[model samples]
Target: MEQANQNQDYQAGDIVYVFYRNPHTQDVANIQAAAVVNHPEKENELALFLYETYYPLSDEVAIYSTEEEANQAYHYYYGEATEGVLE
Candidate 1:
């Protein structure tokens, strides 16, 4: 969907998210990482494979290489997500 379309113009080292399902229970996992692997097919949708270490979770809802980086970008973009640094 949007991931395949939007990824065409992005290059490696770019920030992106990969939509994946857990192998055992098939639960959804939202993974974010620097674009390290590229899949050009439209079905692939995303141009990169995410590095596992950078993935975020509920308790770790906010993630970036640096706190300053996350704060600078997403701090005020949305109402509900504007916690921590935005406060």
Candidate 2:
């Protein structure tokens, strides 16, 4: 119920910002802009369009309504996430 309500905040054409880590290099991470779109294969489900891929829109993802928010969140989370990754 809560997830459904959250999904409603963005329409199919809405743009959102999210924290993304390089799949190939866990040490590299940053915020990325994504698009909210209906899932290509799922009915009535929302998906995030990023890097030419579709990811399910859910709480597991750190999504922000604006770039500022995403940047703030990235600073906070990145510090903790990369604590072991030496520069």
Candidate 3:
């Protein structure tokens, strides 16, 4: 039960979902599947693999174990979409 607010540690190779914003279309976002992998530049830490990039796995990032949870959070946060780009 990995909820967005849980900040649970995920094992490497695990699959998770996140509400990702389109880099090009900042205001639009959608649920995307990501992978938990060993951090390339850190020891004993995990990283998220999404959009061909490795993002550090930390509380700053929200991750969900299921699509339903991700979608739920998406609606809660972005509500039907507007405009906001990714960093």
| Model 1 spans > 4 angstroms off | 1-4, 38-47, 51-87
lDDT for each residue of candidate 2 in 6-44, tens digit (9 for 90 to 100) = 444778998988768889998787777899999999999
For each predicted model, how many residue pairs clash, with residues at least 3 apart or on different chains?
A: 1, 0, 3
- lDDT per residue as tens, model 1, 1-87: 111332135444666433333466563333334443345444433333444432322222333443445444443442234333423
lDDT measured at residue 47 in model 3 versus the true structure, 0 to 100: 92
> How good is model 1 by TM-score?
0.33
Any idea what lDDT model 3 has?
0.76
What are the per-residue Cα lDDT tens digits for candidate 3 across 1-87? Answer: 345764575899999887677789886677788999999889988899998899978776778887767776776776765322122
- Provide the overall lDDT of each model, using Cα atoms, as 2-decimal numbers: 0.39, 0.74, 0.76
lDDT of 2 at 6: 48
In terms of lDDT, the poorest run of 10 residues in model 2 is 1-10
Candidate 2 global TM-score: 0.78
TM-score of each: 0.33, 0.78, 0.78
Off by over 4 Å in 2: 1-8, 79-87
